[model samples]
Target: MSGRAAGGGERLSYFEGYRAIGAVVVVIFHAYQHNRDPVTWHWPLEGTTWHDLLRATDLVVDLFFVQSAFLLGRPYLRACLDGERRQHARAFLVRRAARVLPLYYTAILLVWAISNPILPGDWPDLLLHVTFTQTFSQAKIFYTNGPAWSLAVEMQFYLLLAVLGALAQRICGRLRHRSARLAVLLLGIAVLAGACDGYRLLAVSAWRLPDTYWPAWFGLPAKLDVFAAGLLLALLAAGGVRLPGAAARRLVGAAGIAVLVGGSVVRLRPGFPETFVHGVYGAGCALVHGASVLGGSHGPRWARVRWLVALGGMSYSLYLWHEPVLRLLDSHGLLPERGTAAGFGFTAVLLLAVSLPVAWLSYHAVERTGQFVARAFDGEGRRREYYRPLPDLPAPPQIRDVTEVLSLRGRLPAGTWPTRD
Candidate 1:
C-alpha cells in the first residue's frame, strides 16, 4: 500500500519528515531537564544553552499544527465535494483521535494513580484534560501532561478545518477553478492574520486593548496560518503548482528558515486574536511554505532510517510519555541532582536507560494496540473505552493481576515491578 491509499492521488508526504523531527526535539528538550549536573552530564554546553533549546522547542509544536491542517484538510476538502470524501471523514477523524487520545489518556491515568500534589485537585482540571480543551483557556493549561496542551490546540484546529471545508464548499460549489481561488483566499486569511496582528502590536498601545485578554485566542490562531499554508500547498500539488524558478525556490526556502527562527524569538503578547497575529503563526507559515516547496529529506543521513521514521510515527506517544517519567524519576530520587556534575551524568545514563525501553514498549504495546483498536472499531462507544482502573486501586492486587503475562526478554522478575496503584 504505497504508504498512502492506492493511486491516492498526489498525497502530500512532506509532513512525515518534519513531524518526526519535531517530536524528537520535544523529547530531547524534556530529557535535557534530567541531564543538568555540571560535573557528570556537563560537557561543552551550558545550562542556558539547554534552556534556549527548550524554549525554542515550542516552535516544533507549530509544525504539528501545520501537518494537522494539511493532512486533515485534504479529507475534509474532499468530503465537502465528493461522496467518497464524506464517506471517509468518519474514518479519518477516528484515526486522528485514536492516534492522540489513547496515549494521552494513559498518561493521565498513570498520573492519576500517582496523585502528586503538584497537579490540580479540582474536577475542572480533569474535565479540561479529558475534553481536550485545556489549552483553549488559560485557567490551567499543561497540567499533569505538559505536552498534551498542543493536542488541545490541534483539537481546536480540527474544528477550524471543518469550518474552512464548509466555507470552501459554499464559495466554490465543486468547481475546481473556483475551489482553488477560494483556497488561495483562505490561505491569504492565514497570511493576513499574521500581518495584521504584527501591525496591531506595533501600532496599538497596551492600555487601549480589551480588558479580558486570552492567550489561546492569539496563540491558537497563529498556528492556523501555518496549517492553512500547508493546505494551500496541497491544492498547489493537486494543480501542479511550482515556484517561479529554482533560484526563487531557494530564496523562499532561506527566508522561511529565517522566519521560523525569528518567530521562535518574538514575544507573544495578549489582546490580539490568535489567528490574526502571533510570532508562532509566522514561523509556522514559513515552515509550511518551505516544506511545501523544498521538502525531500533536507536534513542529515541519520534522519532517513526506518527506525527514526517509525519513532516519528510514535513521536507523539514518546513526547507525551517521556516527560512525566523523567519528572517522576527526579521526584522519586531515581534521577540525579540538578547542579552537580556527577549527579547530572548519573541522571543522563539513568534517564536514557529507563526512558528508551518504556518509550519503545509503550509505543508497541499500549499505543500501537489502542490506536489499531481505535481505528478498527470505528464506532461510538465500547471500543473507545480506554480507561479502566484496577478494582479498588490497590497496589499489591494490581501487581498480582499482572504476574501471569508472558515474559519478553529478561525483564526483572514480575515481583520487582513497582506495585503502587
Candidate 2:
C-alpha cells in the first residue's frame, strides 16, 4: 500500500471499526460483570477461554483512549504545523465542553433522578459527578453511572489538551521548522507521560500503596502514557511520516497485537501492577492505530460496512447507557438468568436488542444536539460572521461529521498534502 499523509479533515474508517468493536466488547464485558456470580457458577462458562476472553474485554477501554488522543490531537497539531497563531483557548474549551457535557450531564441527572435515595451524605459525591471530578476519588466513581469513570478521566485529558494546545501554539510560533518543533514537543510529552506511568507503577508495586482499580487505575497520570501514544501517532502522521512496505506494516501490526493481548493477559493477573500493564496496553493500541492507517492506501473496505459504521456512530451513547440499562433490567428481573448457557445467550441477545435501539435514540436526542450546539459555538455554519480566517495561513481543515470531530475526528485525505518538502 502507498503511504498516505494524514491531514486535517480526513476520516480513518479503520479506527471506526475498532470503535465499534470496542464498544460492543465493553457492553458484553459489562453484562458479564453484572451477572458474574451466576455466569461463573456454570461449569464450562466458568473457566473456559470464552469466559476468560469476555472477562478480558475490559482492556478495550484503553483502546478508546488511544483513539481519542489521536483524533482529538490531529486538528490542533495540524493547525500548529500550518503556523497558525492566536489560540482561541476560550472557544476551544467551549467546543470541547459543548461536545461532551450535554449527554454526560443528562446521564448524571438521570442517575440522580432514578436513584432510590439521594442521602445528604451522598451530596458531595454527586457534586463530583456533576463536575466531572469523580475519578479523583475511589468512592465516587461508581456511585451513579458505573461506566462514567472513564468519562471523568477523558474530560481531564480534554482540559489538559486544550490548555497545552494553547501553550504549544505560543511556544512553537517562532520556530522556523514547524515539523521539527512539533517532533520535539511530542517527544517531551511522551517522556513526561512515561515518567508519570513509572511513578504510578512504583507507587503501586514498591511502596505498598493501595492499587484500588477506581482511584489508581482511573487517574489521569496513570493513563497519560496511552494518551501520549495517541498524540505521537497524530503528530507523526501530520508531519507526513509513513510506514514503507508490506513487511514493515505487518511487523507493526503484529507488534500491536502482541502488546494488546499480552497486556490484557497481564492485567487480568492477580498481583500485576496496573500502571505498567495499562501503559503497555495503551501503547499497543496506539501502534495498532498508526499501523492501520499507515499500512492502508484507503482504510479497509470492511470499515465501510454499514452495520459497523452505524454501531460506531452510536458507540458513545451505547457506552454511556448500556450499564444503566443493564442495571435497570437486572433490578426488574427482566433479563434472563445467567447460570445456564441458554439463559446467558438469551440475556446477551436481549440486552443487545434493547440497548442498541435505545442508544441510537440517545445519540440523536443528546449527542447530536450537543454537537450542534458545540458547532454553533465553534462557528461552523456561521463562520462568515463569528469566525475570521487568518490573513496568510491556510484555512483550518473542514471536517464533514461533527460527531467524528468530537469523538475520533476526521481522516487525512490521501494524496492531498505533500508527503515531504
Best by TM-score: 2
Q: Residues 1-421, candidate 1, lDDT per residue (tens digit)?
A: 0012112222333344456666666666666655655566553236455455465665666556655555556554544434233423355456656666677788887775576456555667778788877766666676677777777777666655556555655555555664565455555556645654554454345534442444434345435555666565555544444666656666666777777655544534443333333445445554445544444323334544556656565666666777777787878877654655455556556665676677788878777775566655543323444565635432332343444433322554444444434
Q: Could you tally the backbone clashes for each prediction?
A: 9, 5
Candidate 2 lDDT by residue in tens digits, 321-389: 888888788889897755655666666677788889998999899988976776565433223245666
Worst 10 residues of 1 by lDDT: 1-10
Pairs with backbone N, CA or C atoms under 3 Å apart (clashes), candidate 2 = 7-412, 10-410, 10-411, 10-412, 11-411
- For each candidate, the alpha-carbon lDDT, in order, equals 0.56, 0.72
Cα deviation at 54, candidate 2, in Å, is 1.8
Off by over 4 Å in 2: 1-10, 38-44, 84-87, 117-121, 268-270, 338-342, 379-421
